[model samples]
Target: MKYLIVHDAAPGQFIHIYKHLRSEGHEVVVASRRGTTHRLPVKQLVYELPEELKGSRSGYTAKVIGLGLSLYEELKPLAFDGWAPDVILSHASRGASYFLRDLFPRARIVSLFEWYYGAPNPDTGMDEGAFRQQAANAAATNMPISRDFDCMDAGYTPTLFQRDAFPKSWHRNLEVIHDGIDTDFYTPANKRAIEVNGKRFRKGDEIVTYAARGMEHTRGFVEFMAAISEVQKRRPDLQVLIAAADRLCYDPGEKGKGLKSFVDETIDYDRERTHFLGLVPEAKFVSVLQVSSLHVYLTKPFVLSWSLLNAMSVGIPVLGSASAPVQEVISNGDNGLLVSMDDGQALADAMDHLLADQVEAGRLGRAGRETVIERYGLAQCLQRQLDLMRG
Candidate 1:
């Protein structure tokens, strides 16, 4: 079957699936933003908005509209080609592939729906402010995509919590299938150590790890810094290994300040005990997890991060926030410990508790790994994706 995948940026999970499909002798075509190396059959397309509409300060809706228009113009040529797809998988919520229906009317179209924004949700409360108001209004951008929903055969989301974010009418069309983790590759080591600044961490060291794509309010970056300070007061022997950029990827309203600003003002700890490794390689990242006595992951009621599952798969105990996406994965005191996102003292206590008892930590970590193997294994997830596409 000829399968066409459309996305603004090449989705990582889909790229893996594309390779799997090719191995099974299926024709797969990926159209996305240029300069991404997918190692597959891809048509690179770059869409640039007019100079007048190009600015970071532009409204969210305006930007989406501009992107849709630009992408439509760039991809319109594909319709003229003799190549026709039997199925189309689009990662769009801003009408990026709404025009594909006109080109391939007979093809079964599916949307890989990641998120649908609404007001007063987990990310933002009922705080009266311009930013909050804008976030609330941002839900209107889904209208264009919603109008085109009937044209789509189905919608796929990684988690049920994420799938529920869309309109009630769309829930029936939505399927909950996670982009699973590779348990065999992310397995824990019998003995693993990593060197930071000439000091090597042994298997018995009290190493705590915190990681994210970026440090910002959404991920509870400031709260983590405060919690680490508290953890230091109790366990001076504890060493923190953080993996993230110093700047904010998600706008937290502030312009110049980031985690660095919070560290300078709040965190007071010996330089030797704290290490900020800015985005280490994947192999090195796995080494950090191997040496970790405990791992902390926090986020608002948003998307479930792959890092959390990967850390769990590494067989290290995790202390995650008791939020929607996290609660779905972690059961308190069973597989992992769940703490409040706002409670720094609680976070510190959880870290200390896990560090103090290696036996209990090991038990939880083993259970966490088992959970990933059972529920989020790559083979099971890939099979589900194949089933969805075949339908």
Candidate 2:
């Protein structure tokens, strides 16, 4: 089968899916707004749009209007290129869906439901009033796309969650497939342990952790920092490494700036204990996970990040918040630990327990890796996508 996979950018998860489809002997083409310069295995088709539509904008209204027109203009020529698609899989909702449908009407349209408007906690990068209005508009845009599509697919979220967020009637078509991990790529390696500054870590050095970008209040960065501080009070040996690409947001000097409101000022973080190594390469990132004893993944009631899954794949036992997708994946005291989203004390306690119990932590990490291999491996996900297309 020939598949056209569309996403805003080449999300690592979607790229894995694209590769999976290709390995199964299916012709896959990936469409993105940004030009493809990276060495991804699949065929890439870049959708060029106007300069105004590309930059960081204030409201969703302008973006929606710009996206709709830009997509129409960009995809108009694909209809006559003799590049007929058997299925059109997309994320970011209607823009890609509508464009692909116009190009190939008979193709099965399977959209990955990463989010819906009324979900418990959404990542709206704006004020409350503005966010609500934008969310309503986005919901309005998505409704028609869902109605028109033949199938809707979700990676981690359950059917009930999707139904609750969207119109209840559309639940019948929703497919809940576990987004798989490449066990081989993420497996534990025997590389020399390195510290945050690339120095060799000593045999018994303590390394507490957090990994994510845009350290906003909603993303649980502040809470994680507080938790680390609390944990460090009792276990003074522990050092926290906050690994991410954008370090400017977390800097105290950049407060009150645009999007910097997400940063919290109350927490008095220790500079020496808290090391922010702004975005290392992928190989080094994975190495950090392998070397670290405990990994803390915190989020509000939002979508599960691919990073958490990758952590699991790499055999790092995670202490995550009991939110929607985290709760869905992690069973407390089983594969990994789950703590309350808001309670810094609880998070700190969980961290302390995991750090103290080396045997238990190792067991959890091994079990977590096994779970990924058995249930959420890349092969299983690929077969599921094939089944959806065949159906």
Candidate 3:
């Protein structure tokens, strides 16, 4: 089968699935905007918008209209070059290809749906003020996207939580298949000592870890820091390691300061005990999890983070926010523990419990890895995706 994947950026977890398709002798081509397209093991076509469509209110509006046209225009040359695709897959947010159905009338077009926001959302369900108003306004931005989706052949989402976020009408075409984790690579290892800043941490050291793409309120950075201070009051021997960019991604306003600023304002914990590894390499991250006594992950009612699954795959006990998305993966007292995102005291208590009970922690950690191996294995996810694409 010939495949044409349309994305705003490079293939992320789809890289593994792409390789598998190529290995099976299927031809694949990627039409991307900002990725190392030449470096990927596939034919590539590039599309880009003018530089003016960047970083302003008017620019954002121009980008939305211009990007769709640019993507469609770039692919016209490919069609002229005699490269016909059997299927077209694209991110739902990139509504460009929704207009190109006439060009590939025979090909099935699948939208890789992620989030669909509207009023009364889970993210603002507990809100009492401006958050609710902001979320409702944000949902209006999806009007054009919802109209474009009407022309899609099918839709696929990584989770039921995300799938349900869309209108109930589209649920029939939307299927849930997570971007799986590589269990073999993420499995527990007895790395006897992990060195950080010239200090070696042996097996028995009490280490606590919090990792994310960014230190944002959506990930509960403030709550995590407050809990850390409370936890330190009880166990000053605990060593903390935070791995994330120091800025916000979802909400980038001045009020959305980094974790350090939050810590500086609210907490008085010993700075010497905490280490901010500010987005380290994969090897270093895995080493941190391997040596960790407990791994804490907090998030609003948004998409589940892959870091949570990665930590679980490494066989470490995770204490995650008791939100819908996180709750879907973690079963309390089974694979991992869940703490109320609104309760700082409960967060500290859960962390202390998991860190103190080594026997129970080990049991939960093993179960967590088993969950990943059984349900979210990479090979299984790839096959499931292929099946959806074939349909």
Give the TM-score comparing model 1 with the true structure, all chains together.
0.89
Task: Provide the global lDDT of candidate 2 against the true structure.
Answer: 0.67
Candidate 1: regions farther than 4 A off: 34-42, 56-59, 121-132, 144-148, 197-199, 251-257
* Residue lDDT tens for model 2, 1-391: 8887776675444766676666678887776766533556767666544567555463444555556556556556666776677777777454544445555677776667655655224564566876676557656656535534544443223224443465565556666775667788888754547756655653246776677766665467777877787788888778777676543333223343323234345665666677777666778777777777788888776555667877888887789888876777788888999988799889888999999998998898888888788877888876786677567
Ordered list by TM-score, greatest first: 1, 3, 2
C-alpha lDDT of candidate 3 relative to the true structure? 0.79
Higher-lDDT candidate of 1 and 3: 1
Query: If the candidates were sorted by their lDDT against the true structure, best first, what order would they fall in?
Result: 1, 3, 2
> Among all windows of ten consecutive residues in candidate 1, which has the lowest summed lDDT?
34-43
Worst 10 residues of 2 by lDDT: 251-260
lDDT by residue (tens digit), candidate 1, 35-115: 543445555556544566667677656766676677677656766766678988888566567567777888898778877
For candidate 3, write residues 1-391 as lDDT tens digits. 8988877665654766677778989888887776445467678777776666755444334566666777778788778888678988777664455456767777887777778766554564565666665564455457446745776777678888888888898888788998788888888877657888777886669989999978878899888888998888899789988888887766523444466687677777668888888889887788888888889999988878888998999998999999999888999999999989889999989999988999999999999999999988898987888888888
lDDT of each structure? Answer: 0.80, 0.67, 0.79
Q: For candidate 3, what's the RMSD?
A: 3.1
All candidates' TM-scores?
0.89, 0.81, 0.89
Cα deviation in Å at residue 71, candidate 3? 1.6
Q: Which segments of candidate 3 are over 4 A away from where they belong?
A: 35-38, 59-61, 94-98, 120-137, 252-259
